[model samples]
Target: MIDDFLDGSLPAVEEAVRKAAAAEIMPRWRQLATHEIVEKSGPHDLVTVADRLAEAHLTVSLTALLPGSVVVGEESVHADPAVYAALRGDAPVWIVDPVDGTRQFVRGEPGFCTLVALAVRGEVLASWTFAPALDEMAVAVRGRGARLNGTAIRAGSPARGAVLKVAMSHPDYTTPEEKAALLCLDTEGVEARPCGSAGLEYLAVARGALDAVAFSWEYAWDHAAGLLLVEEAGGAHATLAGVPFRVTGANVLPFTAARDQATATRIRTLLTAP
Candidate 1:
């Protein structure tokens, strides 16, 4: 069923993503009231009405699109962590981060997006990243190439001898050990900055505008869509153990996704250096 849908119903999924953003997100952009936004873990971690409503909207619409499918949404997991177990269940799972950059969204910045990935068991089969305010939608299917607004895209290898530009997880979000691993990117020939939105940073890597991304956290909703996009665009990703990242957790921290395998290996090496 999933294979047949991936072959022909991809656009249906795309439309579902776009509809969520249009109906629930864009309307609240820069117009949020004080009561509409609230903190989850801390001030830096926020959840707005837009996020909750959008995820709810997607949950209903997506499950309706693919009967028997389940959703592992950020807001839903926050409400009930047990909902996250769906990722490992037999049912097809929709991993969703309804608002990827809630902090940016609350601040009226246009750097946020909606991320959705279709995963069966542990493998991501298709994904969508929709940045409504920016008017960009990126789609990726397992065996097919990636696309941005209907045009094929690729993550071309970075130039030799050129400095590697990397977006890394912010220090506040990392443990001391993970922070130490990410700090390895500070060496010569690599420019590292705090990441904005995990999805957009992955999109940057996929489109070749950014060299790579080294993220300490491993939330499937945050990395699932982008990782698939990067992979379909001819890029590669690796955890500290130098293996492909797993959506089901227990991954070596501070994973790197790069334009190509060599870059991913180099980043992994740096992350593991003493």
Candidate 2:
């Protein structure tokens, strides 16, 4: 089936994406100026030349690798929603955020990365997050276990009354689901903070930097790779609806152990309506 595409092509894809991202990003990362930073909103929504360059490189390379596919990109959408609507529905698609942590990148922080995903029809088939700055790559296929920098990973066992450490955002723009996530953190007595960037938030949970992650909503490029990484890292990652991770927003994702599954599930119940 398509497994070969992942087995044979994944390693190659990870390397190419990493090189492309680094080439377009690292040089401009705080060390030098690529372009003037522009704020999308309140100075947190940021854009830079590196983001554009990295996405451009990814789009070109992805076109070569899978000419039969179309690309759905973050910048394209930001530039114009029309670009998103114009994507070819006739073929598979690559969902990409050339640089997921734009604010982090602009701020010269290490939390930002390149997020890429391949989806057929409406289901995510494969995904990757290349954190070039950290020399780490997280990759995942539909059924294959997720891998971080090529190492096998799994979810940890659950715990009880866990002091869940979580990542959050200001409740202002957050959907009802996001608010519930923050509530769960407070209810569970876990420390929580707005870690910034969907990619970074998920990475922290996968690496044990945080115990769980609850978000209002996330797009495919934002959560696809990270979802796989968390699951592969031996952690429970599911939306409030308890669905396998999807790009849908207004959803809460909780990473917990077996012991906390019940608690996590209870909290997730509160997020179901949205």
Candidate 3:
């Protein structure tokens, strides 16, 4: 069924996956738990019941849809060293973060999302990021471009010497590059809202809300789906080194195509120049 669906031989199977994702997710969106959330990285890093449930739901349904495809979810494998081992094996893997913005979720913010991405041979093949709160899902394939809800999406603006909107992680834990980018880039427009997720930032850039986002940490499940969205949405993204995003384990400095990659290239060059 997986092969058939990938080969464009079964639309029903694809629809089944989509429906399963939504059905298994919506009801539990804002539901609370009786217990406190777990702290993965630190006090700011959060894990909730909704995260585990959504991931588990996706895993179970996708497993039935595509038998033999490996599944690595955020709630489970993040702490399991065995996951690293299994992921290094010779198999297609689905890297999912059922809830990408758990911090925001806990804060009753609707910017949280479900990230579903398929990586084959360590390369991202297809991605679907569902922002339940915004009723937006950015779906992208390698060659098919990207879309939100059923309409096509694209990125076509830049922020320079103007009002700029930027998103970042917690400043208390922000990386050096992220801080530098904020300081060095001067703009009249300041809509700097640092939420708990990179997925929403990427989607905003794709949909033309934010102008750029500089990540202080490495890329995770949150940004992979966003990377595809930005790339397919006609935006430009690269590491701090100015390298076009590939499978490298590097953090990203995402800028709009409206900047025509010049700003990104300049920033990357500035960051990497030593």
Candidate 4:
């Protein structure tokens, strides 16, 4: 199954993501009525008809594409938290975040994206990030490297004595301590600010548009696709403990994904600095 997925099945998965976004996401982009959007946990935490319908669409299509494969979709897990356990299972699992930046989507912004990743036993093998509104698609296969709109790309090289441009998590979504740690990036020789859309942030790291991204949360649907993309693009992501970021939905907060391991270590050090 992995071989087939690498050889030809990937395009089908990519198409499924694109179709879901087109059918259930894009059409409702700026056209959603009041009733179609709802707050899941808070005003900032939103869910729309597009998010639910697209995850449903992806769940069916992706499972059909790989028989016996399980789906760990955001909405499904939200409904039944047990669905997320599939990431730890031996079966091939599809981790789907139908709309990664739902907040942006609800605001009729273009930063939203659909993220899907194929994983087995916590290892992501292939991933697709489709920013329909942005008309950008990023695909990565574990060993074959990554591509953005069909062109190969690599993460930016680490700065040599130059101020690093880092995107830290917004304070609104972080704990006080985490915010304080993130603020360390503001010290001399660094430019730091909050970032938009986890998916786009990772893509920026992969394409060399940004130096690195510091995230305070570790949700599989949010980071799985982006993690694979960055790694395949010759970047690295690690928890402050100095280990590879895991996708089993259980990880330390305040992780950094950088253009390279050296930069990642440096960012982690600065973030942990006293």
The prediction achieving the highest TM-score against the true structure is: 1
Evaluate model 4: give its lDDT: 0.90
Computed on alpha carbons, the lDDT of every model, listed in order, comes to: 0.95, 0.66, 0.65, 0.90
When 1 and 2 are scored with lDDT, the better candidate is 1
Ten consecutive residues with minimal summed lDDT in candidate 4? 244-253
Writing each residue's lDDT as its tens digit, candidate 2 over 1-274 gives 3455656777667767977876888888886464467766666677788877888888888867766777788887777766554233557678888888887777788878888888765567788877777787877777776777777655454355656666655566665655654555554465666668777667666666666666655555677667666665656655655765555334434322211254346445544433
Q: Note each model's CA RMSD in angstroms.
A: 0.7, 3.5, 3.5, 1.2
**Local error of candidate 3 at residue 19 (angstroms):** 5.3
lDDT (10s digit) by residue, model 3, range 49-117: 677777777777776666687777777677674674444456767778887888787777787778777
List the candidate 4 regions with Cα displacement exceeding 4 Å: none
Predicted structure with the largest lDDT when compared to the true one: 1
Instruction: Give the lDDT of residue 68 in candidate 2.
Output: 75
Q: How far is candidate 3 from the true structure (C-alpha RMSD, Å)?
A: 3.5
Residue 15 in model 4: lDDT: 88
Residue 116 shift from truth in candidate 3, angstroms? 0.8
Off by over 4 Å in 1: none
lDDT of 3 at 270: 42
Error of 3 at 109 (Å): 2.2
Residues 1-274, candidate 1: write the lDDT tens digits. Answer: 9888788888899999999999999999999999999989988889999999999999999999899999999999999999988989999999999999998999899999999999999999999999999999999999899999999999999999999999999876789999888888899999999999999999999999999999988889999999999999999999998889999899998899999999999999999984
Q: Rank candidates by TM-score, best first.
A: 1, 4, 2, 3
- Model 2 stretches with alpha carbons more than 4 Å out: 32-35, 85-90, 175-181, 248-266, 270-274
